[model samples]
Target: MTHILMIEDDPLILGPTVRALTAQGFHVSQAMDGAAGVQHAIDDKPDLIILDILLPNLDGWEVCKAIRQRSTVPILMLTALSDEIDRILGLELGADDYLTKPFSMRELLARIKALLRRVEMDLQQGRQTDRVQVRDLVLDLGMRQVTKNGVELSLRYKEFELLSLLMFHAGQAVSRAEIFDQVWGTDWLGDMRTLDVHIRWLREKLEEDPSAPELIQTVRGVGYRFTAT
Candidate 1:
């Protein structure tokens, strides 16, 4: 059974959500505040987390950052705030998916399943490659590690995945839609900004100068391409 931790303060929403997930045969855990949610995440190590943006003790952003620093567990954020900046901020902080309030149980369940499927696919593929090298960057596929010029780079989960995808398609311009479908899953409903944020992060870590990136180049209104020279 897949374990899911839901950190939501509102009992009205929480009760039905938990019941629905439980009916789907998921092992569900609940936390009413951000502090408790973070602690449960560290101690129990759930397969995925459903976090709310507003909480009593700590906010969801802080909780997301804290968990991300330690684990690569997939996170699905819930928020009443529909602002684009807030959504982008959650993605920047390492959220895998975002859902606004007044969401249906059907959509939420579908998103959760998509995320789980993506993680499973990555785990299965991890055994195929030992290492991939492009220019000065080396990716240890099995270990999910990356190094540039013999120096290790600290990359988040999505950042590493984005780099791996681009490196796999070196010398070819990969469309934004393709990248999104592969990396974030075909059911991804987030804005294009999520991909853009991850691309910026990869350039900052792998390129000597992020402003004028040579490795991952923009294809002018199309998508991005990796030039392995």
Candidate 2:
């Protein structure tokens, strides 16, 4: 059974959510505060985490940073804050996905399943190729590491996946729709800005100059193309 750690303070929300996930055949673990959540993540090593922004002891952002420092376990952040900046901040801090409060259970389930599926797909693909080299950029798929010009680059989970997809289809124009469907899963209903942000992040790491990105070129009115040369 897939194990999930949920860090939510509100018992009202936590009780039902855990029960629902349990019914869906998931092994659920709970943490009422961010500090405990961080500990559970390190100790339990759950397959995925459902983290809330509002918590006692430590905030969700701190917990996220702590987890990212140690593990690459997929994270889905839940927040009552609707501001785009908050959402972007979470993404920048390495959250795989984010959802606002008042979200339906059905939508939440879809996102969870999508995130899990994406991880599984990545692992399966990793087994096929040990490494991929394009110009000065080298991707060690098995190690889930990337280096540009012999310098290792720190990439979040989504960023790594985005680069992997582009590299897999090097020199080909990959449509925005195809990328979203493949990376984030077809069930994702979130804004497309998520993809835009990830692309920018990839450029910053992969391109010598993010302003004049030559490695991952944006195709006008379409999506992006990865130029190996």
Candidate 3:
């Protein structure tokens, strides 16, 4: 059974979520504060995490950052802060997905299933020829590792997938729609800014100057193109 850790402070939200998830047959672990959430994430290492942004003891951003420092566990952030900046910030802090409050339980379940499905697909792909080298950067798909100049990079799951897709089609302009369909899936209802955020993150890790990236170049009016340059 897939284990899920839910870090939510509100009984109104937590109670129903736990019940629903349990009914769906997922082994659930609960935490009522951000600090406990982080500790549970470390000690239990759940397959996926449902995190709330306005957490006590520590905010969701801090908890997400702390967890990312150690593991690449898929995190889905829940919050009432629905501003575009807040959503982007959550993704930047390494949350894999974000959900606003007043969301339907059906949508939540769908997102969880999608995230888990993506992980499984990635695992299966890892069993194939998994290593690809573009210039000095080396990506080992089987190992879910990326290294440049022999130094490993700390990339979130989406970041790694984005890099892999771009590198696989090096020198070709991959359209935004194509990227969304491939990386986030065809069912993705999130903001288009998600792609831009991941791209910036990739540049930060791979380029000598993210402000003037040479490897992952914007194709203006289209999408992005990756080059061995």
Candidate 1 residue runs with Cα over 4 Å from true position: 126-128
Candidate with better lDDT, 1 vs 2: 1
* Candidate 1's TM-score: 0.95
lDDT value, candidate 3, whole model: 0.90
lDDT of 2 at 126: 42
Evaluate residue 143 in candidate 2 and report its C-alpha lDDT on the 0 to 100 scale: 81
Clashes of 2: 0
Candidate rank order under lDDT: 1, 3, 2
Off by over 4 Å in 3: 126-128
lDDT tens digits, residue span 8-46, model 2: 999989999999999999999999999999999999999
Tens digit of per-residue lDDT, candidate 3, span 44-100: 999999999999999999999999999988899998997888999999999889899
Worst 10 residues of 2 by lDDT: 121-130
Question: lDDT score of model 2?
Answer: 0.90
